[model samples]
Target: MDRAQEGGINDVGIGALFGLVDYRFEILAIMEHARHLEEDYGCGPHTVSFPRIEPAEGTPFSQRENIPHPVSDKDFMKIIAIIRIAMPYTGIIISTRERPELRDQLVRYGVSQISAASETNPGGYDEEGDNTKAKPYEKTGSTGAQFTLGDHRSLDEVISMMIDGGYIPSFCTGCYRKGRVGADFMDLAKPGLIKEYCKPNAMFTFREYLEDYASPETKEKGLRLLKELTQTFPKEELKRRVEGNLCKIGEGERDLYF
Candidate 1:
């Protein structure tokens, strides 16, 4: 994925490929696979996919063997190394299970995105911090209880913190909308077409955030940041597209990115 991004390919999204057993090994495999993708196929701007990793059914929380605990410093360093290698191009997104310390470490290592207040279950947010119903919905074929991290903050708090920390908490939803995926999309995206879609989408989402969620001070800061970013990129057509799309985002789509 790094190579693809470096080579100017922009459409690929790589999954984290996590599984049961050692998360250490899983992290290593993710790094290795990303490295291979960068070295060989030139996939760039990758997304680190998060699949639910849960203990087997009926296993009590205390006895759950495969659950991820806070990673040790050594393992954290390895994760950092992987992130640093991929940071030049790909976007790393860590899900909610990661401990606050680990999340801080990964942020230091250049993780670019995150999911805040995520629930695996449908309609889970309606309950809002209720752990019992936050479990994965049966319709989704998920069996384990839901998990929360980092004090189960509201979306506003998370985004506020993200902004204060100097990260772009993007709520982009372009890849699916743009019809850019699968094997065929990869070929056209090799020259950075995906970035064309993603950048504008990010800007629009940021704008929508300001319009809907920002406090006066946050809105001021966000606008300043947006102005600076626009200056850096300087693409009028893309700017226009972003403005147009911002209107399409429904009023109800509030807490998806946090």
Candidate 2:
């Protein structure tokens, strides 16, 4: 389990073998354990717990059971309630398997981040059209890789789509740097402690993309969006930081966020 967490496992981060099996009880235990860890040991920053909500094969969508499975609407609401009471600072990542309208509704109900154009397989990004190979590190006996549910897109495509959908495709990397991690970080984060760092970094990454990867039209659109967002905050200081970061990025800074 610790190995799984270190390897970037999440609710959606299933191994190839686990993906094929219907280990419903085991999955529930995992989710419950995560919840307990966050509540007792302060290990999670965002909502560390996830409900086992994926529907089983041959199950009718309308009659799906809640709890230890893809939660029913009522149970989902209950989960949110529990989260608010026990872990309000934690964020949820709603998978793409839900209906588009349902997914949108979840976003409104405090889902802080989402995956787009996600490929479960390690080389899936490079494979593009092929869908047969399992992700490099996925366990054996796993189901074959499955495509993302929404418009099949790459990260770039997803960013563009988010922009079109009137959302900021944030690449903020503040929490990791600020030493504000786990549930305790939430107390510091509640009043926007890290926004000071996050905003500048987000702008810096956005600016780098605008100047480098984006086409003139994309640059124009991104700039327009930036202008609108920046106007809401006094961002002169952030602008300076962004410029400095952009310079470092141009100088081949590797592993920087966008």
lDDT of each: 0.59, 0.52
Best-performing candidate as measured by TM-score: 1
Residue-by-residue lDDT tens digits, candidate 1, 1-258? 555555655566766534344667766677677667656654533566544344434555523355455344466556656765644455666777665556656676767677676655446655346534544555656644454343355566666676667666678766655555533455544444666656666767887888877777777887677666665556777555444454454343432321
Residue pairs with colliding backbones in model 2 are 16-142, 17-141, 17-142, 46-90, 47-90, 47-91, 52-69, 53-69, 53-70, 121-135
Model 2 segments more than 4 A misplaced: 1-39, 42-45, 49-86, 99-101, 121-123, 127-143, 146-151, 177-179, 209-218, 235-258
lDDT of 2: 0.52
Using lDDT as the measure, which candidate wins? 1
Lowest lDDT block of 10, candidate 1: 249-258
Per-residue error (Å), model 2, residue 79: 4.4
TM-score of 2: 0.58
**Per-model RMSD to reference:** 7.5, 7.2
TM-score of each model, paired residue for residue: 0.60, 0.58
At residue 40, what lDDT does model 1 achieve?
66
